[model samples]
Target: MKNSFYLILIGCVLLACSTSKPEVVMVTKTIATKDTIRIANDSLDYEVIIIDAGFSSWLDSRAYPRKYHSLNYLESKNQLYVSEWNNRVLQPQLYNPNLYEMTINYDPMLRYGYEVNYLIYNYMIYFQNTNKQKLFGTVPTR
Candidate 1:
């Protein structure tokens, strides 16, 4: 009887452990656009893939002043770019308030006059956390 009771207890423990579910994590944001901007490693790494649109000319015009005036500051640092364009221009219209399709990349170390990039970065962070939570069943503490 004693042996039977011990076996039953051990089996119950194993069953409970096996049946336990991992914690659920939630991703707060979703990246729907391929041109979505992302910043990683505390903004040391930046990538901007602009969708195919007429925005490139606009970005070039706007980014030129920053590039020329802040040459030393911009040099060797990761600069923002469109999907295929090599120049950075800041066209006010490129960041169309009406068009929600443009993608932007940003560095936290650098600030642009545009508020859209800031919004994109925050949105990405939210999306990343939410995604991690979904995958691991728990939101990352970070």
Candidate 2:
């Protein structure tokens, strides 16, 4: 199962590489096996595919537990983080294009349930910490 997920991550990375759009930084290292986390809500038609090497472990160990924060708080934080992330995506010359690869189309009006918001909020925290990028509020530490 783990191997399969890594394969999927590799495939996604390869597909991204094949894009005609030029990247600011070209890094062509044969990706070693890495963790790929897929969070999906079928009824809501939302899916988050995180293809980072240590993300899964960090999430489990460092991220706040589910339900630790209110849904409203999570939603608000996600909105801020996603907006910042998208802005960074637009300004690759200023920010690392590799870190902000794609823009997140997160609708603030939509209620993606607690689980979705929780993961997103935590992922933003993880992303910020790993990249040394600070978002709106102080990131939670455990």
Candidate 2's residue-wise lDDT over 34-107, tens digit each? 56666554433334466667777887788878788898898888888878877987899998866666666666
lDDT of 1 by residue, 116-142 (tens): 333322322233343331211332233
Task: Give the number of the best model, judged by lDDT.
Answer: 2
Tell me the TM-score of each prediction against the true structure: 0.19, 0.70
For model 1, the local distance difference test gives 0.28
Worst 10 residues of 2 by lDDT: 23-32
lDDT of 2: 0.62
